[model samples]
Target: MRSRPELHGTNGAVSSTHWLASAAGAAAFDRGGNAFDAAATAAFVIQVVEPHLNGPAGDTPIMVYDAAAEEVKVVCGQGPMPSAATVGAFRERGLAEVPASGLLPACVPGAFGAWLRVVGRYGRLPIADVLAPAIRYAEDGYPLLPNASRMISALAPLFRDEWTESGATYLNGGRAPKPGARVRNPILARTFQRILDEAKARTSNREAQAEAAIDIFYEGFVAEAIDDFMATAKPLDSTGSRNAGLLTGADMAAWRPVVEDPVVVGYRGLLVHKPGPWSQGPVFLQQLALLEGFDLKEFGFGSADHLHTVVECAKLAFADREAWYGDPNHADVPIAALLDPEYSAARRALISGAPSSILRPGSPGGRVPWVPSFAPSSTATDGPDWLAELGEGIPAIMRLTASTGDTTCISATDREGNMVVATPSGGWLKSSPVVPGLGFPLGTRGQMALLAEGHNNVLAPGKRPRTTLSPTLVCTDDGRPYLAFGTPGGDQQDQWTLNFFLNHVDFGMSPQQAIEAATFHSEHVPTSFSPRQSFPLGVSVEDGIPETAIAELRRRGHQVRVTPAMSLGKVCATGARSDGGVFAAASPRGEQAYGVAR
Candidate 1:
């Protein structure tokens, strides 16, 4: 039996990475808002409650399935580098790779635009109404989470010495607030209120008002403050050197979020949808394609055989990610050929009973993949600079302590069948100096771009960084939406989501059961953050996995590390049921994620 009863409802349902955010979404449903409205409401609340993980200035890539249109679409909220951001500039700065923490890695913020896009086109409530929960929480205060408090305290020294604005904003009496202590962000509340005020002054039309709010973020005082701070400030970075940022007011005005068709692939009679090449989402499709060749049921769930097969496949898929994935607008992505049935069969042949430690990127469509040269950040004897090694950046340090990396997810399903999945991340508070008076930080998404010449993901002017923020939607053969799910683990996002999906579809687990299932992830490929490192044959499995399985993995050339049970994944999901009831589930790992339905 599933450990928890599935959350059932007909009116609506919302699952988010934070309990308060979930409650905010349920409040939207109570106000007669649709899934789109509820998701937007919860997204804003996440920024308020999980400030260390996400903020108003972060990037969010959303996947939405419109019941009316019977179609799934992606909102490309992943931001691009500024026109002045170039490889030459970094070279002049005497940097080998992008610094994990600094303004130099900042990109145009995209979450606000992505959220506005969804609510404007598919929502039933006013912009003001949808944002009310977040505003209230920010102004009135909410109890602090242990994770947030811990992250603040860990970076307290850096904030105090280098980014005073961040210290003043996150610290209470020059120290991190104790867990459960009430925390308020009056300035952040004012920042959000200013957008609503501008929108109300523009017009009474709901869509128009949403557009007005978007304009204020991109072209009004919000943009001005970001530009002023970036133009003058040179805050301490990963290299312990103060550096200026590249983003300008013109970049914000010039950029706009676009609606693109999701990349669709078939697996086990279900059609899966993921974001385009701009995100690491398509890797999930690649993994599924490889696994399709294997009879997973024969190996069985939680078995040593199953663990080895999946880890080996992940290494191959992620190896290709480091070589070929990038912004399709700038790079030639061979999606059609990469997902070809024949190509998948050829790749599947490489998987064996034992694990392979080396990076193995496949050539698709006769196009050679560009593998990065082995270049470590510092002249250290260690193999690669893992997240723990990069202790200077806030994101790396936070992930090292929390186990779950930076980011947050929100999923909602309304009575009308509309479903939305949004993953908001980037612009981590530790990555850049907080914009003065704005009460939020700017995104350092540009750090994901490679510095190698001629590589598809090379850092360049006006190019979107290949981000790790991925949201997924699954549908049946008849094109009916089945599930909307996602999580917040940087490189592990796709891996965790993939495991959760397989648990539900292949193993016949309920939504809650799938999220609670023993989880494992491979870190065999190069990481997405600064000081990028690769573990030739590394696998991290939860303690729940059988000891025999762990021992077998070790004997098979895999470096296995067991973590605490329920400490691996933070997935949140909402799906449509055959009985006309909606179901939602959230990970119980961090005690922050929750799902509510009624």
Candidate 2:
């Protein structure tokens, strides 16, 4: 059962991982803001509330559908490797892969720049208007959710012992705030205020003002603070050692988010859109391609047969993602051939009755199939079964991040027919020290890059690390924008999204039903994070998938891990209809996610 009712609005609808952030988007729409305005507002609010999951120092890849232009464009908010970040630099440290958390994995902060682009180009409101909610939340204080409080508490020991700046930022009086307790971040508030103040000075045009704010972040005080901190400090990283970051002011100044066409695929009757190879987004389309030939609805949604077929397809697609997906600008990505109908049919032919316990990335268009060098000895898992002691009903937001890792998502659609779905992630508080006086930390996205030579994702200056932050947009059969959806799980983002999309498209479920349904995903391919492990034929199913189904899956030579019904995915979605109605839904698995409309 869904915890809350689906919100229907004729004018607009918004959904996000945090209730207040949803309200912020709704409030923007109430002020006559367009979808971009509403989404930008909510995105900032998420940074303040879901600090453990994302921050201003994080990255966001956004999908925007402009009703006037009748086109969908992607804002590539992911930052690139610093100019000083070279494979040789990492090799000098004797590291096989970038450390999961620290300066070593830091990238140019992109969240602020991405938000600026959204408001300046597509939004009806000024940059200051879009950021008001976040500023108020930061300065006046907001009730901290249990998920945020718990994340802080869990990492409090590390902060206290090593990363004191983070401890000072997250803890109050050196203690994690209780759930629902009022919390404030005066420093973060000042940071936003400073940007707004700079933007206000460039009163010539709204776009100019927004660009001024971006300059302040990338070229002004913000950049200075970050450079100064990294130059002087040697903070503890995931390797249990101190390392200074290689990112410099030049990297920040040289970086700017760009707009690009989304990677597109025709799946069944819908036209699916995703970010390019810089993210794992294309894997969703690849999975769809592999599953298209199957009689999906005949097996019935949630059935063991349906589950097995989809899970198997996921493994095949993710294996390809591991082998071939990377920064298309930096690497020669054979995406066109990978998405070809003939190629998908060939990949589909590989699926059989019993599960294949191996990573099998097919040769696309006769090119050699790419594979990583380091193979994990054990099955890969993305969970913190040990954290169950945190108590019952701890929001899946924390578990989603702690278990598999986390990010934050926002979906919005306005009466004007414009839509935006953005997945903003990276720079978790646990990743590194909070920049002094900046109230946020740099992103650890560098961890996604491989250290091995000859690999496409190997560390290189100005190249984007292949990120797991994938947002999705889909169009109706007739080519009109239909739905925008995404989730927060690292590798599982595409898997959970595919599951939810199939529920709605194939099973005829409503937006809320699609999100509320139990979800599952496969870990059969390599994960994006360090150690880059794969689990031959591993599948994780939520508890609601019947015991008989689990038994059948195991019988099919699958290693099945069972989780609580709602513990698998933290997803939020918004849908638009030709009838001028908008629908919004958020996963109730974690009470943090909410859908709001009026």
Candidate 3:
């Protein structure tokens, strides 16, 4: 596939999953707003426009590069479990796992709070100024992109469940809006206006203004509305029965985002920085370690040797992830052991001369000496046949891949050389309405937890959910920030990110070439769904790859399946050149994705 030309450029660039969001950010940069300001604007617009993938209610994990300090810091924009939530509480209710809905899983929305924090610390413009574009878009409808329309149309059924406000807004007359249709969110617009007003009032104190705006939803008008709605509708608790101590005004008030260390790995000549353990960022490092001895370029990009080796490494890394990766505060994960080079090399040695190896149900390394079992037995026994069909059929071909919707990523760079890469997410569209005036939803990330006994990612109170969102950044050998990239696929995220990075770093491909190239996913590990052992170990490739390459891969023991040229990872990339010009690109596979620079 040919690389798409840069969309816009000045000294910096912005790339996001949606065109309007990117344009909004680009406009900020054009108006003399720094990257932080531009990114904040983009983030707000995405919440309003790309509600399915992300919203005000979601968690955002960010990696920011400060050119001035020559240092990188990670901000964990994830909400903690509600103070009222506890494992014993779940057990008493006969709920084997934290339900994806209801009060227990409703953490305070973190993205907005984080946005406020980032803007306060680094942004050049006031929050209100940064948020103007998003406000306008919400008040006045933006043109529907084909991708957003398709997403809405396809996921309409999922939104129909009465738990989310999304069904009310995106589904017109209880049906998904068609592509190219005019879509507006007046409620969100009003909400944005309020935030802008609050922001303007506290121009000198950005954090105070941000918090003031955030509080209205959790403690003010929005909270009362939510309490009232829950009182009348009396939605089922986490177990589909009444009496799950749903979120209260207090729970909303207590929410806050945390700043944490980036998961750093020394790979080749670059220092890779990704958000910490809650996400699968470390898995990329582990894969790099496993491939240390093998020359990836020797196998050639996209060849069977390259794909098979990388997939095997990925499987091993995920096995480690499933066994020991979790919120470090709650779980006794062997973080050091997992990242140990000696351990990684040993695991890599297990991949022998075979197209696919039988996957064993075990941890990557030995069992943690101090960790206790944390598993649940709840099963989704009451879903429609299609979900079951997907559960049954897809698993048979691939295991351990999370197929949930509701995630997106952004990679941005400023003229000053500062870069911000982030993955903001919530699980499948949640219906629990916050106060109507407040346009945020409580997180349903708990759905990502496993119900099986002895699983590493079993649900627990105050524990971060096992997330698929991994935003990453790479710095070149000469101290130049080279690339910022990430994607939005559950388990497929790491797989897609690895391929895209290799395309650019190892093969010298442009950002667009890396993104537009046909991609494949290998699922030989346990996924987030049940019947975890049924999937096949194979590669699903898009049409753009040459037939001969596919044939070669198949000949070398790959289970190859040809699929449409789909965007495997709503992947976006921003590359900074030594010459100081910034190049950005978004996956053409996504209808709403675009690159805008200025």
Report the lDDT tens digits of candidate 3 across residue range 99-129: 5454555655667778777777777776778
Instruction: Report the Cα lDDT for candidate 2.
Output: 0.84
Write model 2 residue lDDT over 93-195, tens digit each, in one string.
8666677777888999988899899888898888888989999999999998776777787767767767888888889878899999998888999999998
Residue pairs clashing, model 1? 427-443
Query: Which residue pairs come into collision in candidate 2?
Result: 401-405, 401-406
**Per-prediction backbone clash count:** 1, 2, 12
Instruction: Please state every model's RMSD to the true fold in angstroms.
Output: 2.4, 3.6, 4.2
lDDT per prediction?
Answer: 0.86, 0.84, 0.67
Better of 2 and 3 by TM-score: 2
Error of 1 at 182 (Å): 0.8
The runs of at least 3 residues in candidate 3 whose Cα sits more than 4 Å from the true structure, single-residue gaps closed, are 6-8, 101-104, 145-168, 214-233, 236-245, 360-406, 427-435, 451-456, 529-536, 546-557
Which model is ahead, 2 or 3, in terms of lDDT? 2
Scored by lDDT, model 3 comes in at 0.67
